[model samples]
Target: MIEVKDVWKKYKIYQDKPVSFKERFLYKRKGVFQEKWVLQGISLSIEKGKMIGLIGRNGSGKSTLLKMMTKILQPDKGELKIIGRVSSLLELGAGFHMDFTGRENIFMNASLFGLSRKEINSKLQEIIRFAELDTFIDNPVRTYSSGMFMRLAFSIAIHVEPDILLIDEILAVGDNAFQKKCISKIEEFKEKGKTIVFVSHDNGIMERLCDELYWIHESKLVKKGKPEEVIRDYLDFLSGSEEQRLKNEVMQQENQQTSQIEVTEQNEEVNKKENKRWGNGAVEITNIAIRNPDNENKFIFTREQRLEVELTYKTTNLKVERPVFGVGIFKMDGTNCYGTNTYIDKVELEISEHGKVRYCIESLNLVQGDYYVDVACHHEDGTPYDYITKAANFSVHSKENDQGIAFLPHKWFFEKGGES
Candidate 1:
């Protein structure tokens, strides 16, 4: 088991305006400087073989916590216990020497990871093959690319055969192929019951890989739960933060005591800027909005709510046949949530090359999250001519607060035979 008991880490920050020369001299000593707590009374435990994720925004003490786990940093007030052999990939090439050749550095680093020379010799070919650095193994470490360095570092970490693994965002550094390989290799370790703790900002991977997650907020452990639940809370917090920031800036500009005339002129200019548009030369999309059954602009809704998407488009050029309009919803990662087009229905009509058209999507089943709609106009022959990636963005605002690719309303029925 791994346990953290009210672990707190503190660092002394020198005052920028230390008054006297004597004060400056005392600032170097702990008693004079201001103490800031990075991790404040955090306590948690992990059963053996469980996979955990530590996540937060930048400067949320994620790095500090990971370093403490690896014994690179000590907590000021609390206990952290580890019962197994641990291998960490917190920083790439942390113990490597730039002046040494790659082979020499690998041997040195592997030995530091608790691997003997005999074991490293047995696994040398496998590690080099995974790293794809056989040709450069004889070259000095300074000559390797960042990708090469990451590959070698990851290869070394995995080859150590640790009972518990600590990984930071190092896997995110490599190419897509290497990243996939890392995911696969980590899954293999999970199958063998090796405990792993990961730190990353990639929510997709975190959701899939971690059984549980720790959320750090404002220098404290604010929440902990399944990955999906923590991510939902984090995203909601981010949305509120952005909204507050915008409100603060607007308030500051409005309250400035000087130049009332200039402020009025600035307001007018802003309105004009908002009204200006690069009207699509071929087609125009106007009045795109989403609504619930009552026909009000709403983001919150039940899965069964009558959802509708409405659009009005005008064409500038002649249309020999009914031009197809495509509407699609996309996830944050660019995957299409769902889409439909008139062309799929084989609708045909003759309209003037330049004319107006209205499209409405009524009662479509949708999952929850922040989704943006993409719109495109094309010919019946399937040639895209005009399109807009961000026609509008909206949140589904699910009531159930579930985590998934899609939420389906399902039920199970239990029955017993009636004396057949």
Candidate 2:
């Protein structure tokens, strides 16, 4: 959680500032300095347990506001408050000691998170492997390239698992594959209810990852709302001349962002599983999440995209023998759109301990509408070990104007005056 009320920040650029008395006396001239406000009365509140994106152009005070969140820079005026252990990737040169080796820097950087020596020791290997610097772990930081430095830095920041994570366009320093891996890790963070604030120019990330977006313009809090809405307005501010040109370009890119991802409807964690959840004490469904086929976290999907459900569970019994997993998709109006189970698909599973199960639909030919899912872990005899009515709710959209509940593959034909 974070609160910045009427926060103001400024920087002084000194033209001819004299540091010593000797220079001042010899020059007999005063320093000419200019005061510039980087953030002006920037009041905003961020809730806990969701991802956030900060959007703006260069010198638009986006990074300045992010720095204030970490208390690295103080606001010249107004109130600033934050709660949680904070970790930041504000700039590449701020965290590591240039003379220290990569392995040594891991201990030093993570120590700042208030972790004990033993704690740091435990995560050292994981950090190095995630950064893919196993070969160069002992190399000095000064000898490393820019990508290697960022990989280590990003790896350390995430491993510490701070309640709040602040990233300021630092993910741009890696290869395409590594960048994708970094994004997937960030998605896992969001699902774990970590508060993340990212300053990025990647529209795809902003659209697909963030729950809310804040737009800063000219050192002021201009707008804050849903990601798609704010991103649309921010893009228009960029085009200036041909307003819709960039918007059309974004539209071609795809799903819930700017014009590209115009969500017709949305919901916020609507798990109405009160009386809907029931089962025996043998096994309990711990949690469930929705994602794209690429294993990326997602709530909004299109008719053409594949949907994957990740279900995690625990068992009181020594082992859940002959466990059958099932998924039932339904319309918001309580219409049972479809249902299926592992028993029907002839899949086998033996859950001896806590584990996760994955159910995938190669193609959901559903029309534009809001829908809910019911997940179950039961026996082959149609007995329910655990069943949730409204486990997760999501919406589907399409570029075509289809009216039915399911998107049907059809073609139109016309015969005018037997012309054919």
Q: Which candidate is the best by TM-score?
A: 1
Task: For each candidate, give its TM-score against the true structure.
Answer: 0.64, 0.57
Q: What TM-score number comes out for model 2?
A: 0.57
Instruction: Look at candidate 2 and tell me the lDDT of residue 215.
Output: 90
For model 1, the run of ten residues with the poorest summed lDDT? 259-268
Top-lDDT structure, candidate number: 2
**Model 2, which residues run further than 4 Å from truth?**
19-21, 28-30, 241-420
Query: For all the candidates, what are their Cα RMSDs to the real structure?
Result: 9.4, 24.7
294-411 per-residue lDDT for model 1 (tens digits): 6665444445556666655555665435577777878767778788887786666555534444444454456666677777677667665556666566665443546764676689
Screening candidate 1 with a backbone cut-off below 3 angstroms (N, C-alpha, C), the clashing residue pairs are 317-353, 317-354, 318-353, 319-353
Tell me how many clashing residue pairs each candidate has: 4, 3
Candidate 2 accuracy as lDDT:
0.83
Q: For candidate 2, which ten residues in a row score worst on lDDT?
A: 260-269
